[model samples]
Target: MTDQPSTDRLSEARAALATAMALHEQGDLEGAEAGYRAVLALEYRATDVLPLLAGLLGRLSRAEDALIAWEQLLAIAPDHAVALHEKGLTLHWLGRTGEAVAALEQACALDPHNAIAIGNLAVVLADAGRNHAAIGQFRRALALQSDNLHLRHQLRRLGAASVPFWHIPMMNDAPRNDAFEAAITAAIAVAGPDARVLDIGAGSGLLSLIAARAGAQHVVACEMEPLIAEMAQQIVAQNGYADRITVHAKPSTDLAVGVELDVPAQILVSEILSSDLLTEKVLDTFEDAHRRLLAPDALVIPRAATAMGCLVASETLADYAFVGEVSGFDLSPFTDFAQQRLPIHGTMTAWQRLSDDHELVRLDLTQAKHDAVLTRLRIPVTASGRAIGIVQWMHIDLWPGVTFDNHPDRYTDGGWLQILHSFPTPVDVIAGETLDIAVGHDRITLILLPLTQ
Candidate 1:
């Protein structure tokens, strides 16, 4: 190249870079992107400019382009922490969780003190369902910045996600525990010490401990939540049942006949029922156990669960269930965003049931498979008022002699609460009338709707 031409090319590159920066500041993203591309074509500080271009692409919601730009930057500066972190975030947004984790791990390794990178790594790990590794990353981040609220929240969320929903209330209710233990002890006498026990959803490893205390010889337990699994491990050791019970930190879906257990269990005990029957994926979990994890004719604990609820009318709750015009504005349309389900502490909340208790849904836990379900029914109103929603509870048949429930009428001070399944809109109902409703499961969620009547 001639000296004169090289000088002209350098000047042009500098001018393009300056114009790009100015346009970027003015929020003219398209103009800025064009100028940056022109500068990059001249190969002037391409590594530095690449990150800038990638960031702009991300802000523009052009994730795929952003990812490509970041990957190119990484090719030039392989250990660049920021590039790795950005690339990982982009990958995660693209739903490529495994690659996202690998990139974030590299970022964390290169910059061990970068709390942001560590936090991102933890999140992607959790998204990939590697809760144990996610917990480790969270703990490492916490060790560096103990007072980080975001990290603490993540740790607690993961911990809670691991525990079965029923465990919280069961832990809180001493009376219920006593009743269940008494019934379990009786059943163990009939099942005998030689029974091969399987405890699914082993929250704090309590049920397995109970079985051990009742003299069962072999016990296998599986917990879907990692934090809870760790806690259950500790509790089992403390209770001296570690030798008898083997706790697997995985869902029932991961268990196998000859792998996790010596064989399919003879007495299957799982306490995974949510306050609302279908919300916890209990139907799927139980079916998997019956089909693969348990032997034929295995004695399943909580043999069946029924979702019991009563229609409710409350002016206090109507404001929560619906939105309407106020102060001369047409704001009623905001009601479309009302919550489908609201968790309420049964004893703490002041609300009245307006109809007789009815069965909303029932799950037979012993079934080998369950088809997706939605059904329509009519609920009679006992009082004349604005019907806001339905307050629902659970009834569990733990074993032949054992049973437990969080009845909205009398149960108090439990971790599990009677949830308020709100209607899409407030409906005016007269005393002694009926409201037609639709109820079912969308595989992973419970569906409740008040039909037009």
Candidate 2:
């Protein structure tokens, strides 16, 4: 380290570097790049000159050449934080996602406290579709640079890309929260203070905190998203319940009975139902919990969930589900590729119910096993129009005498929104006709479509 020449110790190299920097600042990029290369070839301050040359190359859209310059600098100093960080950015520009992530990850490791480096790593990870890891890195960067709006914007943009926009509003739903709190309080009451509780999908640690506040001593919670899990841990600790609740950054299926938990939990409280009720993988997570992470008789919150819906007709929703007769052409076949399901504010959106609400699908969470269910249900039409699809919502049986639903009729302004399951093509129906529809789930998604027969 002492043998390393400081800028003041290198008279000739420092003068050359000054001239190169002047050329760079004066927008003589070509001249600057060549000067930097000439200095590096002289065995001058390569560490200094390489950065300029690499950055100039990148600016000139020579990302591959910039990458080479960065690699050369890295060879001389493998742990150089700037080299790794710039190399990562260059790799990202070149669409080398894997290499970008590797470089950025190494940069973050070398300069753990550098928020910019961490943020760059997060960006690369997100582009690579490793969203969970990317979120964690952005959160870490945000923690370091709290007032950075750009970082905050990136976090929100990436978050929206990864999660549903309703999550924030859903967390703000006092009715939904109260239902879970009451159920959790009751579950803890039945299981006793010492009963261990497992909260799968502990987003914001709300359920776990409710369990802790209800006097449950040991609560183990797992969230698949690393960033949310970390935030949950922080929120739990901030509220002084860290001692009672442990948050694990993993999916419940990855949890081992004695490893991540001191034994199978006695009570399971999870709020993971999607609008359609299965897209969040609640069935898979809960079944795994029952098999490996929960006590044989563990009380499950939301013991059951049902997808309830009715036939609907709406031009507003129809526009979203179908497109045809654009200006003056028949492109009706494109409807085959239209979105199958769409989420909308049921009360806010104009829709006419053609039939009374019917049960579409139900899941018994208390049961340890579940298979894909497909059944033919008949919807007796009461009003007739162009039947776009079924507008569906959820009815969650949280506990005895405590239930919640985002019923499309009276329920408005909550985290939940009614989802429209569009048909392959709009079907015209008349009153007093029963629409035979295939209504069930394929284990992971709800099956709601009108049957041709």
Candidate 3:
């Protein structure tokens, strides 16, 4: 009968499918792909063939094509887990982060047990800087797969990325904290309780709290790091200053006049100075804040900052600066890879000052604008020795009579450690000869270079 012929045709199709699978197993990808396309052309269980085709496309690095294939597969089987997951990954690779996050979130929702989907979602969230949500997703993934090394590493990195190592000790440092508090109180007294206060880089929310305690009625603080911002909020609440302070979890660059603050602040308090003075992008941050966030006559706390340094020679630090011969190899040519300047605890280390304390760099926080700067200077050498590097420190002019500095001679155990601005190599300079040096900041980094005269 005619029915017999139709049955025979079905049998032939099944046999062709079997041959296609066999070829696929034998590494005949092109032939297998052709066979699969043929089978799909017949509309023979296209859903089942979709995954195989998608995989082949992915293997060929045709992510766009694979994405289209997955979209078609998901249309047929809306709950298709693998299609959803693969589409999410492909989208992520294409830099379509928002959509990729949505798709991956759906995959995880469908299969809560899928650790891979959970981890991918967490990673995407972190990439988007939704760290608080990413932290939760990471925790959920870790709960599912407790021994996952990658997940643990991600969590640790996120946690540590927010707070610098100096924050805790800086918060607990009585002398430094007292000096800043006294200065903040004085600033608030001058500006009055009605002064619109803006605290940039609100680490531990300490300065903002001090401003609040000094009778500031309204204070807006910002911390660039989300984790620190969250912690600062908690700390503010704990100290009962939450009513007076408003913490914005964003960088100062993200702040707007009408949105975050009602108007330009009357007083601006920011402590983002690094040990090397300019490395923390302090100059740029302050300049932006002054130009856009502050009133014309805003009282900028620590109105000025200076980078102080002394030329020095040290045998202990020379080993860290140069690498010439190691294991009897002539790697002296590779000494060019050494760090030009290294941050060291000036009081903790022993190095003679070959030059007096000279101002290497200066930043006026009250300035409304800034331009990238570099200057050439001649440092008079006072001692005779193999000069290793320069020992540097910071002096902050908070307010009149309220100043704080980690002088290399006396201050110890605060957030700031005196930095050893090491030279590239041992340069022998005798007394009465001047060392030519270049100093400046590229808005984000401190540049210190020794020039040959």
Best by lDDT: 2
Candidate 3: tens digits of C-alpha lDDT, residues 1-453: 123335666676577677778878898878877877776665666788888888887887888988988998999999887789889988988889999999999999999999888988988988887877888788899999999999999988877764578898888889888888888898888889999999999978999999999999999999988778988999999999888999999999999999999989999988888888877778778888888999999998988888888888887777778777789887877778877667677667667888888898888888877777899878999988888777888999988888888888887788888877666666788899999988887877666778862
Angstrom error at residue 377, model 3: 5.1
Q: Tell me the spans in candidate 3 whose CA falls farther than 4 Å from its real position.
A: 1-72, 89-102, 108-116, 125-133, 139-153, 325-337, 347-352, 369-382, 431-452
Return the lDDT, model 3, position 305.
86
Error of 2 at 170 (Å): 1.7
Give me candidate 2's TM-score against the actual structure: 0.85
Clashing pairs in 2: none
Q: lDDT tens string, model 1, 259-308?
A: 98887787877666666667677877888878887779777777788878
Every model's TM-score = 0.70, 0.85, 0.77
RMSD of each: 6.5, 4.4, 5.0
Model 3 TM-score, 2 decimals: 0.77
- In angstroms, give how far residue 278 of model 1 lies from its true place: 0.6
Off by over 4 Å in 2: 1-55, 73-85, 101-122, 129-163
Error of 3 at 445 (Å): 4.5
Best-fitting candidate, scored by TM-score = 2
User: Model 1 misses residue 272 by how many Å?
Assistant: 1.4
lDDT scores of the candidates, listed in order: 0.82, 0.88, 0.84
